[model samples]
Target: MTRLWIPFITLLSSALFTNAAQASADPLVTIQKKWAQCQYQRSQEKQQIYCFEQLIKRNQQALNSAPTRADLKVWLAINKSSLAGAQGGIGALSLVEEAKDLLEQVIDQAPETLDGSAYTSLGSLYYKVPGWPVGFGDDDKAEHMLKKALAINPNGIDPNYFYGDFLAEDGRKKEAIQYLTRAQKAPPRAERPLADQGRQQEIAAKLKELQ
Candidate 1:
């Protein structure tokens, strides 16, 4: 019953966001909220794959309508990555590559969009994806970009959390703990209640493992 309710509620919430996005004049605001909704539903992969796929189309339309907005590109890229993760197979590589391309543009053309989120996200992709012929994953580059993101948004939860995860993966347990702890204490984003709540849970889980 609980598991069934989880997806039922997720679909209901997605419908509400869809309605709100349709009513919204500003696609950027709509995309941001919708992206948040899509991400929160991410734990339910098959369900979110469908949800985010629809969102990807909407985002492409939104981006086409206003190509000047870098943030839109960022969110679109993020939604793609979200979709790719939900898929998680050889076929998903294309989506990851697509997102990488979009993030590169955001980094070059709009580093400040969403407070250096491009850097953080790009860095994450580098570390998370495979290397060489398959993808462009590179630890050194990831570290450099993640640090740059931190420089731009020192107090941001994502930067700290990702850097901490990177550190943990690299066996720097103490350092990872420091950053993870900071991420746990980072300020909440009122505009992104769902994402904030989800992230806080992730931060807690990461902390538990390291501690």
Candidate 2:
């Protein structure tokens, strides 16, 4: 009868949806675990650049397998950034450039997914690296990226602290003080104290010098 056929079709559709959901969830967990391991190795800071390169290769494999997942792409970006740092520390300029390109792609694709962490990273990159037309660092670009990040997440401590540090460096003392103070009072206090402390200390030292 038509009634019996309708129930069978509905049950089959539900089962298919359940299988697809499971399939989607499994790859994400695997990628996250691999990324976590990479971060853990980075925190140790003793791993050779080759070790990070190997990690990158693994992450690249995972990413190729699941190109549609934004989180995987973000994780891959973070690993690339770390690898860049490691390479730069060893004076490997070409590798650093390659990593920067990868990070740029991640930012272009998913600027909203990682709580604006990519913006903060890009801002730090511009702030720390030597600029074009003269030096490696570009304070103006750093300021713009940091501002965009704060606009995306006004209460984010990382952007607030970094922005305040940049302002302080530029001699905008009062505004720097306000931002640094806000950063110190922001939540996730335990995680951000280093930035807060560093900014507040710099502000204090600068204010003292001015007086």
Candidate 3:
């Protein structure tokens, strides 16, 4: 298994959080900022673990308040998956399992929510988790879900990056480069500087390695 590595902030809309400067009061926006900080800024394993744990609590509270919100469900799923990656072990399996369930619900209820983020995140999970009895990793399913996300948001940075990364990991470097280049040139998210910077660094590193 590759571990559940995926972006916390995928292709999202401004309507989800409103204007960046005025979104400080929005719970989802707060969750997004904290997730970016934890995933990108924090380096220490213990600190990262702590950050994700806190994020999970906050996300859960928000979800409880807005049970019908698919976006909240997606954030909760992301928090759990990120925590699973940080807390690697057999124990992490449960976290990802729950995360998978939550994502499945979002996909069922609103596959296009957050601009197809559920598909992107779910696809990442499928490839990253262990396969067979241990977990549900499946390259075929990963590719399918990733392609679905790409279809919904073809030019989005996260979708292109994820699909490209999937190709690269599968030994299709030439195809990976094409999608990665598009991701590199994808327009920036005005509200997520930290996430954009961090993901760009990751894309650059992957491209460098492939080249």
Candidate 4:
């Protein structure tokens, strides 16, 4: 799916880099942090689009350097998805399709990468996009992927939040509230204060609507 349904997501590495050198040393971590900034901190539509495009390019270069790196591929897909969300239109579908392919690659190579982030992201896409004839949206596949993510990271904020959101969207408010509540109580990420805060606000908003 695009950004509007479920915004671009990146899981923060547990280790927090203290300096620019440390940040640059890990291209994946750097891109993830930048993604949070672009997704949550930026407000201007044009700027957000530019930011996502730049990240996508940078991520693609990283992937080129390390073709076998599933993590890099995952981030590249996320940036592409974000860009698709920002520049919505008939054209956006192509970007998301590209993202879907990248994510699928990650799953095939490393389903356990980033605590099953590929599953969470892929599941979100399945539900957010339109159904066949128009898009490839499928509720059953979405549930399957989301559940796989949940099984991998039971207490993860992203998985729970996303599963809850999926359930809510499907008109299952009671179950959605339960997962959302667990997501709200998930531990904070020392490396991602901004993302944690932004996500919490989103969870709160979702709960408010469901309740």
Candidate 5:
């Protein structure tokens, strides 16, 4: 299973917190900053696994301190998801299972704190993992999770774009075109260029295929 990891930025929107400079620092914010740093490290392709593990450690500490903060829980889950990808790269199935358990906990707690972000993550997990007789990917589970995400936030770019990718990979050409088109038309984000361009290309290609 080749995991498609979503960037942490989408899961932790600036608007979700008050102005960072003006707001007093909390354990949640501190952990979030660490997680953001880890994401930056991953992007730079430097010590990806170690950086993510550091993020997990920080988030775990924060969660222990303030276990009720839904945001921290979700962020922890997101970090675990990234860690699973890192583990997969190294052929570590055991680590992937550990990460999956963390994600499930996040979903069980609050699926709405991150604007249906958890569902998008889980959907990608199911979509990317290789299925039974071979591995763990389950398209049915992927579709269910993606649909739940869409229901929670119909106009969300991440779900639309990723779900489009899932549909395309599953040979549902028309549905894929629809979702990719929706993603391309999504509200602009200053920090999500890759997601924006990827959806645009997906839409264009699927549109061509249908025609």
Candidate 6:
């Protein structure tokens, strides 16, 4: 059986980071800034849920205002899925489904968005959620999509770290360590200081555990 690693510690550890100063005028920018804060600065799950909900509202508004930017869907799904992880109940399952649907569309409509973050996030979701009667978790598909993510972004911190985590959950700790190590060495994201630090911490914990 694959071990359950919450997506918050892995999947959402790499959210968008933008200049807060730039956010004052743009709604999407504001949403992205808050998204990073919700995931990185705020340690509490409930706070994350609240921040995401507020961001989702802004996202929906942005979607209505500027329908051409399909990229917003990616973050919308991510926050919902992150919220799902925070809420440990049957309701959380629905949020996962909603996220799944949104990601599937985002990949089809905008695979190139966010350097293929949709694929990376969706791939992680597959490995994190339950399969068959429960949800849509699948190790095999997780490998495929994760590889696709790497192809799009070989040096991306999120993809590398989650691929390592997937391998670790699948009992390939040795191989997992390889990816985790790379992720730990990944270059800093200028926009997302907090998210980078959080991921580095998670990577350190995972590396130590595996080593």
What digit string (tens of lDDT, one per residue) describes model 3 on residues 7-63? 333445433544656687678888888889999888898999999999999999999
Put down candidate 6 lDDT per residue, 127-208, tens digits, no spaces. 9888877777888998998999889888889999989988998889889999999898888876567778878889999998
What Cα-based lDDT does every candidate model obtain? 0.74, 0.54, 0.85, 0.83, 0.66, 0.77
Best by TM-score: 3
Q: Predictions ranked by lDDT, top down?
A: 3, 4, 6, 1, 5, 2
Say which prediction, candidate 2 or candidate 4, comes out ahead on lDDT: 4
Count of backbone clashes, every candidate in sequence: 0, 8, 0, 1, 3, 0
In model 3, which runs have C-alpha deviations exceeding 4 angstroms? 1-22
The C-alpha TM-scores of every prediction are 0.85, 0.59, 0.92, 0.91, 0.72, 0.88
Candidate closest to the true structure, highest lDDT:
3
Where does the lowest 10-residue lDDT sum fall in candidate 5?
A: 6-15
lDDT of 2: 0.54
Q: Could you give candidate 4's per-residue lDDT for residues 1-211 as a string of tens digits?
A: 2324445564433334588788679888778788998999789989999988888888889889999888788778878888877887667889889989998998998998888889988988888777788778889999999999999999999999989988998889899999999999999987778889888999999999988
Residue ranges of candidate 5 with Cα displaced over 4 Å: 1-15, 18-46, 133-135, 189-211
Instruction: Report the CA-based lDDT of candidate 6 relative to the real structure.
Output: 0.77
In model 6, where do residues sit more than 4 Å from their true spots? 3-24
> How much is the lDDT of residue 89 in candidate 2?
39
Q: What ranges in model 4 sit over 4 Å off?
A: 1-6, 10-24
Q: Is candidate 2 or candidate 4 better by TM-score?
A: 4
